[model samples]
Target chain A: MPAPKKFSRDQLASAALELADEKGLDALSMRALAARLGTGPMTLYNYVDGRDELESLVIEAVVRHAAYPPRPAADWREEVRTLAESYWTTIRRHPQVVPLIVARRTTDEPTLEFGERMLEALARSGRSGRELLVAFRLVVGFIIGFAQGEAGAQAFSPAGGTADEVIQRGRTLPAERYPRVVEIATASARGDRAEEFRAGLDLLVAGLSAGARPASA
Target chain B: MPAPKKFSRDQLASAALELADEKGLDALSMRALAARLGTGPMTLYNYVDGRDELESLVIEAVVRHAAYPPRPAADWREEVRTLAESYWTTIRRHPQVVPLIVARRTTDEPTLEFGERMLEALARSGRSGRELLVAFRLVVGFIIGFAQGEAGAQAFSPAGGTADEVIQRGRTLPAERYPRVVEIATASARGDRAEEFRAGLDLLVAGLSAGARPASA
Candidate 1:
């Protein structure tokens, strides 16, 4: 056998990330990662317990890169916005990780730290308990939901084409059967999804700040 | 060869759904699906163009079953609410399809019918154009986002245990850096995720009705 290779956990994670970027998330088995690292799968256990832990590390890394290292924040909304925007960009670039991010419960250090920072930022909003958790859910759900929507819309376009095809395809939608859909399709063909996502974000943030809590509760 | 099998597209979609339900979504392939149907992989092409078209049919079926046979609506909110709730339950049960649903831009007949119904419900809210599309995105996003959030939260529990284990695991989080997280975690331990999901949905619907549209918009 070749001399054993040495790699830090970060190095391992970076390698795994590249593998995911290249071959897709489902392709990131410990064996594949080990192969990518020029090492044995058994040796991979030194860094992680199994594929699950390796995935968590991968998720943590993606989230860390997405959140801009989570510095101390002045404005809760701005910080939250920054996190959301970064997440949007990160997911857009690395669509492969979207499923992993969605499916895995992130209990890793970086992700937890990021979560803590989000809660800290929201502390200013004065919603706690169920209200606090729900607020977090709303913002996060919106970001993820928007990203999925944008992805789906983009998938309709031919190569190097705008989402106009999605719109054009809808014009064939019978006017009587789906008037609203056709109209929206027309507007959406020429629409900027990024601008619309920001608008939705603005609305959610305003509403969250407007408060999901009742005074008596 | 054995007598050629004759199955409707719906029948094929149902089989595919069962395959997805049994195996994870990743395990789903034209080859695998054909095996499940006791047919050769080439036979699947007769029903679907390929894996992409097959996935659309699968998504359409899920959307159909989840939305309660797509009956004409009376209460817009109730119908919209039904769509979101059933979507939640369907995805929770068929967790495998979540990524497929997220990644595919579904324009299948059943799925489109459902979309038209959702748009019909939202038309009552008096928002259209980009605002209309954004409203639809918000509601859809919220449902998908909440489902994904709940799924991730449940992942923390030890296998074969209730999600309470996930909340219980949060107690070990250091209190200093994550007071809010710990506090929320403590509350979430005994919390009702379903109730919270419904609450969040109500807020988004209310916000959509309140209007994200400007006078000019």
Candidate 2:
């Protein structure tokens, strides 16, 4: 008989995740993962098909770490808020994975479970068919997009520093040219991020209220 | 006097953008860009500091191509939709740049111009200070995030194909477990993306209507 497998898929996934988390997604490859695992690349084929499956595994590993609420909230909005927050927290822990998650749609159990739960809550909002789908897309877009904004702000902004530093820079911009941007930036800098996220989430839920009609449509 | 410059900043920026657009962002470098320009890396350095500045220039090149509305809409909502659509059109042409735009905060003139116009429209919503800031973030988050979702769906989804194909896959998913996801997939497959984006945008605007308040403190 063939020798028993040495590593669990979870174990292989975690190793791959570590490689990506440290060196970035581009640094991940079967050869690299094998090197990290102290094995040859050929040995890895026994577990994964190639880079695509490897990426999915990495996403699965990262998502599996999220601690979802023990029970769904009775209110659909609240359920969305809870799930969104849980997802935000989870992604924050693995900021490097944001691009991968945003770029690829994985069929991984953990990722799908998150989507299923959020969709369940959205369905409860009394929207069905195309409306339900749009709502789902909106929320998903916000959750992932919001994460991108925050992560980008932290990683990319040359002015990315303490809120105080950011606010200070905002105050210094030429008022005539960027009046609104300056004002919003200064004020937003003073506000708590958690509060901002909550407010934004509330806006999405409120916008979907029964009476509101699509302005463009 | 130093030799006359052979390339304008715009020309250099275009060459770099083409490099990134044709190859992935990772393929862009001083050496490579210079080679494309039929010059040495030192000559290229005279125009740009390095990859960071090169990237900013590339973004500027792309954003400059976006033709903003000659005039802002009379209503704040309409203004937002117009600007959002214009920005969307420009970025969709360069889908590869989405990650760069998302990860880095650029102060390029065109990028800032886009932000300034959007902020001006948002300000007309009558939100001020912290409220205005939150509202701006909400809109910006949605705009960028929604784009990411669409781009990702097109580029990364294994089911990234015709609506009918996606719907067919949705139909085959185990209904008992992914009922809501399956439902959304089937219904959303038939809807127009433009309509979906508009509806999602409307949801955010309506959610921010005067009477609605935050559910969480």
Candidate 3:
């Protein structure tokens, strides 16, 4: 009899990703993944070394989905904004995968493409050496962190009730104790996530522009 | 014989946190946690509802540990910087648990205290209403995102042989394909974490000040 056909790495990773999206990351165990693929748990190792590699594949696939029109040869600020927004969009789609992206160590071709494009944009900005990289990281950090918070609160924000009632309850927060928090967080939670992201993005770009601009610019 | 005594919720949460920190978040299952506590899994439920409540306790304790000296009555910029730094420190110590903090729906008392203090500081900056919250979220997003990147790179940055050799490998990239990234990401990987954070923080404060900041200051 012919040897049993095996799943490709991408196929396995895709299935795993689907499993994660459908069930949850906790449910994506080896046996569960094998069952999703119609294979034996022991046989699944033929494609993947184990869970760690599996997660890396999922992150790579997820990152690939976050598409942006390449302003790569254009202005540095716009390029950075586009890249950050794309990444932010990815986080919004697969919020569960944010931690996995942050946790995985390996860099695949697709993920590296995003980095390559981003770095090229930063280069056009006149930032070089450590500054360019630091800028890249700083922008990315803000985007991911903000997106995670947004995703985390989703189950509660719109999940709990309408924004008006939510704001009303939040507004009633004790003024004497957490005056700043009562007003700020309550109001903050009320605003739009995309608007906040764009506004913040503008600030970073402006600040970064001022900090790194060469004589020519 | 007398009835079996029970563990306190805090004690069980603490144990769960320890298990998560020691092994990994995935290892902190109900069965495993009960095993760690030297009690039956069913018995473990007496102190906690189940895995969900256990995770909450762990997140609460993790937030509590990310404490600062509380410059609550201090400068707005300084307060934002302090709170971000403390949160960063916590992520560093317990990188594994960052997801739990983000994933948890309800904000516990300790986490709110940090927020209360941060908002108070943001308020002192003459930003209020929604602007105050947007500012708060932006700063936080940057901090958390940066910390996640830092934590993610740990298994490689200091994990690989030496920084010099790693940079040498990084520098080997073709001068034409990615001169900017080669120079930047390579050098960024070499800088101290705190320095990068502070530098990024300054850029953000400057940008934010240039934006929503009041003219009086």
Q: What are the lDDT scores of the predictions, listed in order? A: 0.71, 0.74, 0.69
Question: What lDDT score goes with residue A175 in model 1?
Answer: 81
Q: How accurate is chain B of model 2, given as a TM-score from 0 to 1?
A: 0.81
User: Could you report the Cα RMSD, in angstroms, for every candidate shown?
Assistant: 4.8, 4.7, 4.5
Q: Name the TM-score of candidate 3.
A: 0.81
What lDDT tens digits, residue by residue, belong to model 1 across residues B47-153?
A: 77777678777877787765464474576667677777776877676666766665556666656666777887776666778877887888878877877766553
Candidate 1 stretches greater than 4 Å from native: A1-5, A22-54, A67-79, A152-176, A212-217, B1-6, B22-45, B49-54, B68-79, B157-165, B212-217
Question: Clashing pairs in model 3?
Answer: A129-B184, A142-B142
lDDT of 3 by residue, B1-217 (tens): 9676777788887888898888878899999988888888898777776677777778778888776783463466777778878877776677677655544444467767777877766666777886776777778777766765554432222233233454555566665765665676567657787887888888887777767556423
**Cα-lDDT of candidate 3:** 0.69
Docking outcome class, model 3? acceptable
Q: Considering TM-score, which of the candidate structures 1 and 2 is the better prediction for this target?
A: 2
True contacts kept of each: 0.53, 0.55, 0.54
lDDT of 1 by residue, A1-217 (tens): 9666488889988899999988876699998999888888999898787777787778777776755753655767777777777678777666677666655556666667667777766666667788778777787788777776664433432121223555677777788877877877877777887788877877676666556334311
lDDT of 2 by residue, B1-217 (tens): 9888799988899998899889867788899999999998998788877667778888778888989779988877788778887887788678677767665556666777888898777767766777777776677777777666555533223435433454566666788998887887777667677788888877777766642243311
**Compared with the true structure, what per-residue lDDT tens digits does model 2 show for residues A73-182?**
88777888899888887887776777677665556677778888988787777777778777877787777766665555332234444334555666777789988778
Q: Which candidate ranks first by DockQ, i.e. highest?
A: 2
Q: Candidate 2: deviation at residue B136, Å?
A: 1.6
For every model shown, what is its TM-score relative to the native structure?
A: 0.78, 0.83, 0.81
Model 1 lDDT at residue B100: 66
